[model samples]
Target chain A: MHESPAVRGRRIKKSFGDVVALDGVDLDVAAGQVHGLVGPNGAGKTTLLGLLLGLAVADGGELEILGTPVGRTLAVPDGVAGFVDGPGLYPSLTARQNLSALASLRGYDAGRGVDDALEQVGLTDVADDRIRGFSLGMRQRLGLAAALLTRPRLLVLDEPANGLDPAGKHHVHRVITGLAADGVAVVLSSHRMDDLAALCSEVTVLATGRVVFSGPVTKLAAESGALDYRLLTSDTAAARRVALDTPGIRVPSGGDRVQRPDADVLVVRGAVPAVEELVVRLVRAEVAVRELAPVVAPLEAAFLALTGAVPTDEEVS
Target chain B: MTTTVTPPAVEARPAPVLRGYRFELVKLLSQWRIRVLLLACWIAPAGFVAAVSLQSVLPADTVFGRWMHATGWAGSLVVLDFSRSWALPLLTALVAGDVFAAEDRLGTWRHLLVAVRSPRRIFVSKGLASLTVLLLLVAGLAGSSIAGGLAAVGNHPLVGLDGHLLAPADAAGTVLLSWACVLAPTLAFAAIGLLGSVALGRSTMGLLMPALLAFALQLAQLLPLPVAVRLALPSHAFLAWRGLFTGPAQTGPLFIGLAVSLAWAVVATVAAYHLFLRRDFTDLTYDGSGRRVLVAGALPLAALVLLTFAVVTATTPAKGSGIERAKVEGSLATAYAHLYRMQTRELHRPDVTEAQLRATASCDKGGSRVADQGPGNDWRCVVSWHLPGATAVGTAIYQLDVTADGRYVADGDGPKEVNGYFQVRTSTGDAPNPLWQFDGNVDLLASTSKD
Candidate 1:
């Protein structure tokens, strides 16, 4: 409803003694958007997220959360609620008690709110059960439920999909999406590229505490450049022959150091048009292509490229 | 960006610190350890009384133990003084030492610190919650001890340090006041425990720290340290109650110890809060199941407080100069005459007055080679007095066991009918003869030179 972005951080710098956590990082997440942070270990993804949640203040930077500039206090703003690292839950308390305790801390008489949050996270079944016995996935779900209790306008979650089962994953996805649909801005960090692509409209790729790329997920997938196609066919010999003859399409050999052994699938590297040419030629040759797909998904490939991470053997081939 | 509208905000805005304290209190009371602590404090003293009452042998080593068979108040006092100085610090640690450290252990600091908005609030809330629990624990311990003692023994008169007899009503009042004075050292130790938790941020360390300090101080009592150093320690505050039962209620050490203990508490708590605020919570939160709930620790803050209070206490004259021979002799003779008169009344015999019975004591510390002086367990005294029907004077030989802190137990070794025994035949059934074996104390700081 307001003009300012839900979370706006500029040139943020945080250091622990000698190690720099976030250096000159700039982030802007609009309301009603699920902004994904993609980074490898120690890339300052969690650190940046921590600054937003007020778990830690930047050594230098300007941050505004929900129109309020974040201060040196170890607390989020009035409309902000999130957890970095993980939801720091009390294992001794039941899922319901954990939420109620947090709510009580905020002076919120969240008797019904606790039940609603638990039910919202599909944890109504184990609401009274202590979290000490909760599995990793269940804990993650409960963490989300705790964050939802405040009805945060800006929610920050670190690895929101880390330990979720299929059902739990779907439940979290729906909650995050629903929150965003209701005008909540969510910023979550995850190592899962699929999660980033599926849930986030915009992604920020951080490496060594600096944002290497920040834009729409669609624009990020476009940066993948070329593709490595895995061709599985009814006639492997025929498909392999057509792929070798096609221009701009080079079939990988067993001698290549990056070659991975595939018993019945042929790997080819080419631009989209070239791969399209090869597919047309294969169709003319009456070779039925059973499976033809990029060896690594586009978003993951672009993330691997932008972060300067070493490509996997399959992607390299 | 599209605007879909967010949910309505929560409107109530109470004081964050009060809310934080309430939350912490709820969480603290829910912990199994905290509950067990409360339960133990409630029942353990009663259990002690029950066990001690079943036997004839008195727990005579303690100040009030010898008279426990006569008065339940004495039994309560005995329990109150039994390892009191040593146990209180550890007990305080169990409640407070792990308070802040537990947040680190359970990885709940993120949630608590975030919601509370200020670390100061968190500190204050946790401190207040711990103090609340400690107050409850102390009340329970004191109440149960008195209840157990009254139930186990009847409300007979108790003996005080100056060998004065306290009526049942007076004894009850004194015990309550002693427990109140106990809060001085207790708060000091609790602050020390909080300092340990905040400074170390580890449960085991927090728990071990207060226990270690307590043991060290207890052991320190054996060493010939400077009296000034001894007077300054938070541990020294435990002995503050000694002055309360002394003749004229020697209040110097009581007031000094109260000031010293308060200084220790305030400074240590400040140091802990300072450390807590400066800490950066950048470490990854531990989600391990191996985590122990708020364990307990010690801190340099205790040492800092010790030296600080010590410096202040050092400027004053140090008490604990040991019981004087004359003071002991006088206290003993006065107690003997008082109890003898009371004993005659119980026997339905002719009444005797303290003025008529000229009781005098001649005591030697070690042997005939030594003059009657100073504090020692080996004291022999001849208490000669007059009886109403006897023509000649009667004498009672008493073996005196004295302590450096100005208390003694005098064992009567005369004929049972004349001096006393465990029980004596009285007109109203068998009754406790107050003249048998008696407990008393001399003011260590009382004027020793009787001119």
Candidate 2:
């Protein structure tokens, strides 16, 4: 028999008192897919993740996780494991003890999984150290290790890379991608567009407790209206003249202009097709197109256009 | 490419509740706070007994305090009595009050809730763990007190409240039973602490509220409430074991106290379980809005108190006239005889014979015409005894106070030459003997009259 989607929610609504944390939100996640959840702060990312993990029940609408429909009872579907609002841990316990405690609570022995998870998170060296002494990055890695102990088929993580160094981030990305390759459904919420762009096959953009966009990463960029680009060429004056002369491309005026006026670069704002047309003209005009890059990443530009504000650091995490 | 071996799935178990309980027990035992509290429980009582034994005079305010320095068994009884008043409740709260709130404090509620589907199961597991801890503390306190008492004072016959003497074995058993009797109320306090923990979501509130409630209830017992109302309070149950040390054991209060304690436990636990099942764990730091909890908790308590009041009002009769003359006369006569014999033997007096002394007593309740029964502070009794060198037989009027629970205090107004002490001639010598002398006061034994 074919397996159902790992998570399915239809117009799920959740409210706390007068504040609507989630409003008419719909989501679908399938096995072997990494679904990225992107939203500004207070956009209901954590609330939705909480619902998926069974830390809470949706106030209204249907939610199905791991093929089972969720009711009012607070319960995670089988094969679901993750953490929200950072992982909750006993500060006094060693990393190994924390994992062992969680394992024992679930009625299974840690066996070799504890060590394997620790090694996977690059925390094997400090496995015996109490969590009280762990840095934020170490704690986040330990949380991932804890989730791995369950051998979960569906993993939900909120800002799994919140405090990780570049190396730690690489390890986490590997583990998450590795899990997906093993047919696990992963739902990750993060503010880092690069990580999302790197790992997510599909992304869901939320704004004001509603979904603004959901599809492949390419669609998000394709749908964004226009973005500013930093252009560098062998001939700056020629590139600037060619760019301004190109149809549908405009050199931004006033305070919106590029900060480095003396440098051999031209900042232009226009749709991707228009920008492509300008690049074509530059090359044809023998003003070699040395470089062409959006000032903000396509994902981040789209996020800004969709959410109306640059994602704050706290929001990204 | 690398390959990994997948571990086998764990076997299914029949009792998930038991597993959850075991998990909770493990969590609690791993905490250093619990270990230290238990160690204090074991050692504090023994140290208290040792300190009290070193004092020349016994503490007379607490029940059995007068006998604390008398024998090991009595010392244990004194500690047991003191524990019932406050220490038992506090000890129970030490574990039960923290079991649930600690989850909130440590932000582990989300973790545990995600792993354990049913909140009710978690509640039960935590409750059971708290009970287990309480049992351990009680056992430690009891064991330590017994050991300390045995080492400090030698085994001796214990004096009962009704002037009856209990053998050494019976005294030991009675002491154990007294400790056992308080367990029912201690469990009730544990349930209350658990309820507070769930309702308040703070360990400090959970720990302090139950202890304060216990203290308040104990103070309420001092009021002249009807027996039924008194029986409803868990604190009253702590004193139910006092009946066991009487001439004929009063098991009525013992059984009633146990039932009342169980009732309170059931009510508190059920309420706590209900609240826990409905609680939202999404916000780990929610301090629980106090108004709703107050209403939830207050309704049940008000209903219970009103129900107790109604029952007590309907069933209880008016207080009896005063201490019964026959019961008091019999108790006083027997106690005086024992004291006189002890004095004569100690003084090496041989000429004074028990029959020749011929102690006689007459008692009345402040000149009332009503039947001499019940409890009062104004009962008067006159005793006439043969003096060693007096021309006429001496008469002394004793002012007596009787407590509702069947205890008495008596003060004698005799000639200055007699020094307000009961005097008798020794059997082996001509020296005069003083009876019932402790802290310059004469001790009298009183009995509860069966009406």
Candidate with maximal TM-score: 1
What residue runs in model 1 are displaced by over 4 Å at the alpha carbon? A227-271, A277-290, A312-317, B1-15, B83-87, B224-227, B285-327, B342-363, B367-376, B381-398, B412-422, B425-436
**Leading candidate by lDDT:** 1
- Span of ten consecutive residues with least summed lDDT in model 2 chain B: B437-446
TM-score of chain A of each: 0.92, 0.92
Candidate 1 is graded, for docking, as acceptable
Clashing pairs in 2: A191-A316, B322-B373, B348-B429, B349-B426, B349-B427, B349-B428, B349-B429, B350-B427, B350-B428, B350-B429
Model 2 lDDT on a 0 to 1 scale: 0.74
Q: Top model by DockQ, which number?
A: 1
Q: TM-scores of the models, in the given order?
A: 0.87, 0.82
Query: What's the chain B TM-score of candidate 1?
Result: 0.82
DockQ of 2: 0.28
- Tens-digit lDDT track of model 2 for B1-451: 1122222222222226777787788778878888987897799878877778667666655666655555667777777878887788887777898888888887778777766666878888899888998899898888888777767766766666543557889999998988898889898888888888888887477667679888888777655455556665667678778778765575655776787788778778887888787787876558855664576665786676667546544544312322367666655544454445455555555656546666666778768785565567677777666756666876656666766544565555554333254344433222222333211111112224442
- Residues B77-124 of candidate 1 have per-residue lDDT tens digits of 776786365557777878888888888887777766667767788889
The per-residue C-alpha lDDT of model 1 at residue A27 equals 94
- The Cα local distance difference test for each model comes to 0.76, 0.74
